[model samples]
Target chain A: MSSEISSRGPADHDVRDQIVIAATEHFSLYGYSKTTVSDLAKAIGFSKAYIYKFFESKQAIGEMICANCLQDIETEIRTAVNEVDGPSEKLRRLFKASVTASLRLFSDDRKLYEIAASAATEQWQAARDYEVRIKALLQDILLEGRQSGDFERKTPIDETATAIYLVLRPYLNPLLLQHNFDHADEAPTHLSSLVLRSLSP
Target chain B: MSSEISSRGPADHDVRDQIVIAATEHFSLYGYSKTTVSDLAKAIGFSKAYIYKFFESKQAIGEMICANCLQDIETEIRTAVNEVDGPSEKLRRLFKASVTASLRLFSDDRKLYEIAASAATEQWQAARDYEVRIKALLQDILLEGRQSGDFERKTPIDETATAIYLVLRPYLNPLLLQHNFDHADEAPTHLSSLVLRSLSP
Candidate 1:
């Protein structure tokens, strides 16, 4: 653990990437609280000082792991949403894919889900940032729907977007989703239909 | 404080009511965690032993305060819902009154709102019971709407009611509502319309 891996400068950009990957693995496998800076260094044959050269502290590493999870979700949302044409179908696919992506991300790695849950309770920067992204995504869909006359809104775009986000809570929010796991298959389909029906002119 | 308010036996029913009233004042004024059993005992002119005779702990007293708040909200909702005729109007008033009643409760007593927030985070028994009571209330309204041909449902009564609960969350959930206090008057109006429109035949 005392041995440093890099012949390159400690501030090297590659080292930062390595630190995030190793930290993500540790967070997703053993759990967030249990993983130490020392363990992160050992995972990549670096010393604690070298790890600090990249991430300021364990908390920063935790932030990076949460950011990584949201990024993964965002990428899937974009792909699913872009795959379709028109606002109505795009809204349906995008909303459904967000739930599906999160389920897959958490179900495959329980520890990552635990990290997400912890982030939510602690009100971590990453968690709040994730919400902004989702709301923006919904806002775009609603705006497009309104412009194209495919849907009508009962409120302004921001409020309508927020209402849609809240309505899909049981299927989208990981904490609430945990309680409704029995309806894992049916929830997205049912809730999305309710949302679409609400928007239909 | 050592002087007993009554050797009439700690089981006197009025003693229990007196304790709850004093505790609510202290909790609303000083704060839940700050208000101790000793403080409560002092407030009610009773000994600590007398306080313990009624509530097992400070936590129990906190639970009672939260339960009292929910009961107040329920009374308002029942009165408003029952006063109106037609399921649409009943549902509209029921949802609106729930938000309005909660806003009034939390506004007049910020510390009590804090207690409710704490109870929610701690998932206290009293909090869970309050949710069950609300869901039942919503279920009754939804069923009535369905039977009266004022509403059509895409799901069972329970799920529809739960979805309604989730949808009204921004306006109804104490924690979220605290941030949106400026919309205090408008939230119920907008959200109620959303709820009614969703339920429309």
Candidate 2:
């Protein structure tokens, strides 16, 4: 997140960012079940009370770390949106970027994502929240396509966008992503083409 | 399995079928880990030795029951294919049948589906096998569409169909199916329309 400083504006944003990084490292190196908030604070040269001042509980800190990882994908989507010339290209890039970025979280820290994928647990709420945000981002891209005439206007844009998100669920889902990663690692590319062709005017 | 009688030639089919039905009932009601082959044998008024003659282990019986359920779905797809007129209609019916049937597994027997979704376990192989058959069924639909000129012939039908399966993973996968089932309960309709629209010539 040191590279993401330009996206921040809060006075204490740096401190929170540092804490997030420290917590992520602690959770990764030692298991999340084994790491406590006090360990996070002690490793970051702060008191446990100070960590609590920012995050309500250990789960909250875990949520923040998950949220931060999600934001990294969001940033990647934003970059894709900005760099493209048309909505089709932007949508393609966004889909590809999101899949690649999300899969990176699993490959980078397998244990952390294993915790995140435990749908029966409380932390799954954070993962579901992240999914909603991703769907919203997809809707935004579809709306842009409708305005630019790259996509047809026959159906409601929201429905079409939501459908696209649903169709891409297998690629975006961490649990399903591993299966696609093996088949020449080309599901995102194939899916982006299928989606683009589906929307063409 | 009456229609599938040709798929087997053994005279002991009746006994095997009864044992399978008993085991499925036990697993569905009491959970897989708690259900044993001995209990299944007793429930069906069969000796443990006779039950062992059919299935080497309790898990083997469980796998057969799962395989039987999956075959029921395969029969559903076959009926849809034979009853439908066009490839587009066949694809639509196939998609809807798969989504609804997969979701039915979760809703109809949450305990059984829950065990199936635990992909880390050994029984996940059966689930994986079921997925491969579903994908093959999807490809068959796409192939018909391509041949009938209902869908474009530019892309490889296999890749395109695989992409569709990937996109609909949320609805088709037991783990993700439960989440979508609680939301609007109409994702199958929406997903079918989206996939069919994408395949149009």
Candidate 3:
């Protein structure tokens, strides 16, 4: 990875991706407070000054990582919804995708989730922006389901989407980062059942 | 509070209670790593020797505080269940009381919840003990409702109770401490509807 980065031009997009990958590992291991730019630079074989050239600060790097993870999750959810046939199947796939994405993101580096949660409280603007984007994505799926006559939801789609996110948050949130991932399987199962039951005709 | 302590005999129980209260505030403020026996001693206006006389270490003091908080919550829940008239009402009151107690305990001290969540990971024994006690309490309530025909649950009461707790946990867990308590009012409204809808014959 270091050799690839050295071979690339300074302005190459791959360099940015490499930095994010390294930062993700560092942040996961040391958490936000302990993960310095110097450590990230060292991990990726880049100078601290070069790291700052691409990302303004450690917080900026963290924000990018968060956005990247959430964006990937959103894409997966959209693809899953598009591929599945029925309302029940759609809901199952949607939640399964969410759980899988969330678990995968947090599985290797649990501290990233903790940092995200802390960022939500400490950095209101970024956190709220991320939340709005997520809520909109959820709303779109629900609206799509309703339009297809597969889901008969009486509650406002947006409100119901927000509620579902809030209700499933404990399982999704970073605070559960320390819990054994193997044991966390029950959450997605129960949550999918509850949401499907609520939305069932 | 100090006067009340002074009035009690200088027995080990009184000393232990005083230390626990002080420890709660200390743990609530700086969390476990930062909270020290000296800080707790200072908070209680006691010497380090006196502190050690009642508690073995800072970790033990933390354990005691958690034990007391859990006991208080369990007692409140049991009392609420007994005082309420019917299953629906009992369930509602139980939810209300649990939320209220959680809010009261951590309302002014958000770090307490953080400490608890962190402690759950750092101290596995305490976490398992706490989980078992809570499960038993919820199981008892579910059994009572089933015996009275107030709940039409086909699943084993223990499993059903665990499911209900998991569903309610996002709202109640300390990690989501930043949540608006006003939203809690809406939670039970939604939860009761879900419960009634699921369990109604």
Q: Highest DockQ among the candidates is held by which one?
A: 2
lDDT, residue B79, candidate 3: 86
- Between candidates 1 and 3, name the one with more favorable TM-score: 3
Could you give the fnat of all candidates in order? 0.06, 0.52, 0.12
The interface RMSD value for candidate 1 stands at: 4.4
The collision pairs in model 3 are none
Location of the lowest summed lDDT over 10 successive residues in candidate 1 chain A: A1-10
Ranking by TM-score: 2, 3, 1
C-alpha RMSD of candidate 2: 6.2
Per-model chain B TM-scores are: 0.86, 0.78, 0.73
Give the winner by DockQ: 1 or 2.
2
**TM match of model 3 to true structure:** 0.70
Better-scoring candidate (TM-score), 1 or 2: 2
Candidate 2 C-alpha lDDT tens digits along A1-201: 875655554745777778888888888889677888888888889999988877788887788777666677678777876888777888888777877777887788886775565532453676788778878877877878888888889988778877787767666666656555663267678778888878877
Q: Write the per-residue lDDT of candidate 1 for residues A1-201, one digit (tens) a residue.
A: 334446455647677877888888877778888888898788879999988877889888788788888788888988999999999888888768977888887789898888777776676899889878877888888899998998875567766666567655445556655554555676666566667766776
Candidate with top TM-score is 2
| Deviation from native of the Cα of residue B60 in model 3, angstroms | 3.2
Which regions in candidate 2 have their CA more than 4 angstroms from the true location?
A1-19, A33-50, A80-84, A118-140, A175-184, B1-12, B36-50, B77-85, B118-129, B143-149, B182-184
User: DockQ for all models, in order?
Assistant: 0.12, 0.46, 0.22
